[model samples]
Target: MNGIKNAVFTDKSIRLLGKNQYTFNVESGSTRTEIKQWVELFFGVKVIAMNSHRLPIKVKGRRVRSIKGHKKHYKRMIITLQPGYSIPPLRKKRKELELKNTK
Candidate 1:
């Protein structure tokens, strides 16, 4: 089983696509080294570097008569791959859309 989930496709992540970096949501306890290894093994690409961010849990609503809890916290990893290796799903959909537009 894979320890890391699919790459995140948020606006920020999309912006980083051209730089050959991708983002994925990983288990909270996963370490940076583990993430790097998973990226390399799963994608069959060399991971140049990796950085992880722990998302802050947001406090919800007002103290009185409102939903009272923090949002789920998770870790996000940004992995930069070696030159010439790209995560296909990220660009694959885009290329297809472009091709459709040109037709």
Candidate 2:
């Protein structure tokens, strides 16, 4: 769904996968209930719990000018699913497949 931007696969998030949890970058305006419903409907997994936090804002400016800009803000969500349920790998597997095809 539009609310969910993409799956996160940093070292920490990869480790969380072993514990039946998945991490994702979601729209800042998306609520927990909305995300939970979308995940369940899209992935067919039961979400047991969810934790979310907004990533720190990053500001950029030029030394020569007084103008500054802020990067788009987003929220990160860690979702724990019911045992025996899991989301399939997203990017890594697709990239692997593409490489194999190119070879």
Candidate 3:
């Protein structure tokens, strides 16, 4: 967990397909290992493989003079996990059994 646990994750972490792949709002200069560690610790999952993409910097205004600067850049990480382990459902079922103080 040395290189993992950067951020606890924000609401922007969207689920990709159905195989426990999630997208994160990462720093512009985050590396593969750094991102992998962060995701692994945060989600409590074993990270099998990790990939990233650097998005283009967005210019807010049409003319450079109009706006003082452009928007910041971002990097996205696509994480994969081993078999037999899947992420918990994003939503909870109200009808499901609720564990109470049985002890």
Candidate 4:
């Protein structure tokens, strides 16, 4: 897969942060080992475990005769890091979001 695309920060993911887990949206072709290496190298965190899931394709605008189109499917990874390790980008985004919310 192409490099780590982006991180997911939904309500569910936010709750997982308390347990030292992070969610990232990755290319469909990426492997678990690749994700582990990338996270360790980029975030300076020790990845203990990783789980990947493929989201189902979303179909829209169905016609009477046939289907219209479908949104592309994507892979997501949930990474569990060793205690005391945290990703700076994730923290920065969270802080920015909090500031936005407060204002």
**TM-scores for every candidate against the unseen true structure:** 0.75, 0.74, 0.52, 0.77
RMSD (CA, Å), each prediction? 4.7, 5.6, 8.4, 4.1
Stretches of candidate 1 off by over 4 Å are 61-73, 94-103
Selected candidate, larger lDDT, 2 vs 3: 2
**Candidate 4 residue spans exceeding 4 A from truth:** 61-73, 99-103
**In candidate 1, residue 82 scores what lDDT?**
88
Taking the tens digit of each residue's C-alpha lDDT, what string does model 1 give over 12-68? Answer: 776687798888898877788887887788778999888888765434533433235
For candidate 2, write residues 46-87 as lDDT tens digits. 999999987655345323322256444579999999998877
Best model number under TM-score: 4
Pull out the clashing pairs in model 1. Answer: none
- Per-residue CA lDDT of candidate 3, range 56-101, in tens? 5435543333335654455666666776655564312111212221
Ranking by lDDT: 2, 4, 1, 3
lDDT of each: 0.75, 0.80, 0.53, 0.79
The deviation in Å at residue 97 for candidate 1 is: 7.9
Residue 61 displacement in candidate 1 (angstroms): 5.8
Better of 3 and 4 by lDDT: 4
Give me the displacement of residue 66 in model 4, in angstroms.
15
**Candidate 1 whole-model C-alpha lDDT, 0 to 1:** 0.75
Which residue ranges in model 3 land beyond 4 Å of their true spot? 1-15, 58-71, 89-103
After TM-score superposition, what is the CA distance of residue 26 in candidate 2 from its true location, in Å?
Answer: 0.4
